[model samples]
Target: MKSNRFHKQLCAFLVTAACMPQAHADAKKMWVQGSWVNIRQSADMNAKVIDHLSTNTPVFLIAQKDKSCEISWGISGHGYIPCKFLADQVLVFADVATENSSPEKAKNYSPTRAFWIAPSMRGLFNAGKYFQENLLKPEQLNLENGSVQDRPEPQRPPKLIRYSVPEFEAMKEMMNKGVIAPVVAFAPLFSCEQMQEAKRRQVGSSKDEFTRSSNDWSAPDAEKYPYSYIYAHDCLVPEIPKLSLPKIKVSYFKDVQKVLPGNTQIEEISAKFGIVERGSVTGSPRWALDYDTYRYTGAWDIGSYTLTLDKPVYEHVIGRTGLVAVYRWLPGIDEEPFGPSASCEEGLRNQRNGKELLSGYPKVKDALLWFQSATPLSFRTAKINSRAYLAPARSLKEGEEQRGIKKVVVYEVDLDGDGIADFVQWDMWGEPEISGPSPLLTLRQIFININGVWHPFERDSYGECT
Candidate 1:
């Protein structure tokens, strides 16, 4: 009876929050919420200390052992940490009121518990004041169950930017009548093995599309098609030329040879690439910050040139870097000497680091001017592929079927030398479904080349085959 009772207690302890088989199978990402959590060699609290983990560090929960969790610490080896210190969602912290706290004591000031809030509520409320005001209000948080107990409902329906009733009905009628035909588009399809490879590479799903699990996908016919290929589909894609980026104007800087005589200044230098009527290359160049910063875009006559002013708008911050500029050879080849003798990567770094400055470089923003031009390349131009995808724009939010009908055009380039495209450029045009005005959805993202391995930068939208 004693042995059976001990066994029951052991099962009870093991069946705690850490013993989630589904989470272990999925390798669910969890964050360390404690100030300074310790990783131990064993599940015991007094076990040999393996390492110290800082708050917000990500760990993969492997399994549960007593009150501790076996976690994979991101290439740092496996160890056990207290399950209480791990949170399924990210925890944001605020400054707490303290009395007579010294710097030494403040270093170890870890808040006991943190409350989860909707992402939309972030930055809108002062945490301390908001919590104090709403503590006894309706919508009390049920911390025990990680849910809200008496959540209050909104007074009215959320205001959405939507089409008029007539327009929406007309679109539906046309779609039903087959007047608006679904065009042939393509989506990346991955096999089970390919999906595993994608997970190993840390490739994420597209923002507009969710990747289905490998088990749900049928076995790919190897004889008929390659293991991973772009699958074609018929979808409704609207042709909105008004939403597209305006074509860049072609204006050379004084016929290439004569252009250099008077055009030694940065403004004259930038003039090589002609003016790009209105829309920026990165869609909306207005970067929203506490203070104002400006970005201007122009054309690449011979190559692309971007000049940035890191000056403050509201109040200038002392010692900030200024007049940062980037100039690239349009020819897409490294052999040419009219630009530089160093390797492409090294030369680009030099330009960014402000090491290489032209004779006409200015001292202040007042004298700055820009034009667009570039040196003709001896090599052939990089190939650009424009493919249509079924991912909808930000406009379609209410109807799932209508969302799948919307289409986007993706421009791809092979920047990583992997023969497969590692860079994607695309533009989404529409009013957002949400309340606030939508910014231009232009994206020009590339896989960062680190020691020859291309890694995609963190982004909301992504395009890669599993």
Candidate 2:
């Protein structure tokens, strides 16, 4: 009787096991379309999340449901994911093109009224020649016996590559053929911010350092147009003319050199000051093919000067003097601006509550020190340290009261390593408070200890009108 009962139980167990649903033998692989897709335990909206999958994650489709489909979750078991989130193929971002399609394939592309070259074709031509030339070949000198040397090779300025109108039209037409499609369906994988970071990393490093390419296609291709990352991705598309081009020929003043004599030459400043942008002007027969626009931003230290010239004089300067080793007139250390005049001091006195918000934070201390060391003009631009001014709360909308962030408090920071608080700055924003439009209040000031009395020596603010 016992043996018969055991046999009956074994038979029941075998039947239940056989009835259980199993994964399909020929499961098809699908990629996760969106980032951070949830893999749920059951085919329900509120089902427990078993795992998470990121964009382009591969998964095997096991079973199909009404709204969700079961997928093999790693090695342990299967989980259900929404069918809408699964893609039959993976998408390609500009940051991740395994094979770089030739720019020449889009040879029929045309340039807009603002530019001479097809935007799509800018990456194929090297723009780094303007900057990299200074680093590659410095002034070559010929020497013989001591005190006897040949005149140094005349400095060759970086030259811009000129593309004709026909070439521009060809490239534009080629892109229209759909050899390469822009990744506009989703957010840009290689954002301007990412490109800036890549360029920053290449600074001071050798040309070989910048040449190092990643096999990982997901990385941003900063190498293509080292001077301009924007050209690498979006230059293919024509830009809408924002402002009408100047009708007259524009040129930089030769007096620009006279005003700023005794200039200090640097390896590269074009990234900061920028280079002359070349674009074609139609209906103006006087405008030559070699004409270019000059944005003399900080070129003469008299604010930013912009002019569109008929002659290629600016291009000649770039070609002859190279933007990389261009001469700059830097202000002397004594000439650096320090603030907190009587008026500024009077304004800051009304806002100072004398409260310390970030007393023991090491991160804030490190950041302040790093900020001071970042640039030659850091002390002049110390107002950047104030969070209250740089990052103000959004204005409350209609019918919305008690909007978050009521008051911001300023804290004392030790700018120098003297262990004494030398500067007063905004550290953080306040918690949510009763709000209509929150008052924009910010304070940034440095103090000098004179006879044990803290006197405001310098101050900086963005929009503290009072």
Candidate 3:
């Protein structure tokens, strides 16, 4: 009898295990397309070829292996043709339903707009020239005895400088202001003593010791002071374009399980997450895509809950499972302006309340959900120390009541079945106190993943004020 019961339990466990859903497949089909630069009469020919392809010409992506892909040109004459191009051309895939079909026409695409080029490509081309010019040839020099011989000095190593955000911002401002004059004009007037001082300070070394210890100090006028104005001028300027922003690729994911409040706290959760208000109803959680991170937040009767993650969790809702990084979002308590003067003090205050709320509920592990970057520049997690002080909320006037959030959470997700997340969504919230039409929530920063590395999207120019 005991053996029969054990066998029955074992059968039940096996059945349950078999019924469990599997994780979503990561494999995805992507398209690769690019403009033809120079097409010749033959592969090896140097002859001129007519008919340059336009920048936004649509090309069908047949297959992608590693970084290269087989593409079919959409041109009337050209059929299936394979071309060697970088992986950056693989934009987000078509919607999942259309994945199996032929490539669709690209809309609102303009080729004249600048596209990002990978740094690896830049290094390949620039470093090749640098090697030939600086390393391959032997240096010809004249000795004090009037003898000319080929003498190549050892190559100077590259220097790396670490800079803070403020310092970088200052340097950019200076460069834009053109405070520094041309090296040709300024180098002649620059004192070697000042340069030596700067170098000594930078490296934490003294000049007297450096000069006495150096072996190349006895060379001819030019070679002895090889670190002169002409050399200094060349070293000061950088070869790459400083204005270019970091390149990042965005991926979207979809069909993830949505976490709704339990039956008890539905009303509070609705108000907290900006679902229902005085008379309006904000829609359910929508898809969103930012270059950097995925965020979701809503309030509950017990307290407000926020779930911030590095990647979207749409797959989990759709019965798929994968690892995801989680963070607690803590909103600020104080109302601040949307400018440079905004600080993290208000967010810190809100975090204190969040901590209390968390202590009350043992299940809550992640901390409060605070707006890191908003119109008013409320809180910057990167700028503030993790151990900074969190203030307590103060009492409000009799007439003043709590104002609900009027912002939306932006997300980047793969709405299409393609392995990459390309879709972006803005979840809007209504302002209960305001009488006018509902305002669309704006996203201040976007997270992007380019070539498996993550980066934050930065604004190129400041927006004009109305």
User: lDDT by residue for model 3 over 163-213, one digit each (tens)?
Assistant: 223211222222222121111111122223443444454444653554332
Q: Residue 264: error of model 3 in Å?
A: 44
Q: Candidates 1 and 3: which is better by lDDT?
A: 1
2 against 3, candidate with superior lDDT = 2
State each candidate's clash count: 16, 27, 36
What are the lDDT figures for the candidates, one per model?
0.32, 0.31, 0.24
RMSD of each: 24.7, 29.7, 29.6
Sliding window of 10 residues with minimal summed lDDT for model 1: 115-124
lDDT of 2 by residue, 268-289 (tens): 1111122222222121111111
The regions of model 2 sitting more than 4 angstroms off are 1-24, 95-466
Q: Candidate 1 on 171-285: residue-level lDDT in tens?
A: 2222222111101111122222443344433434542232322223322232122111322211112333222221222221113322221112222222222211110112211
Assess candidate 1 and give its lDDT: 0.32
Residue 354 local lDDT, model 3: 21
Q: Candidate 3, residue 402: CA error in Å? A: 52
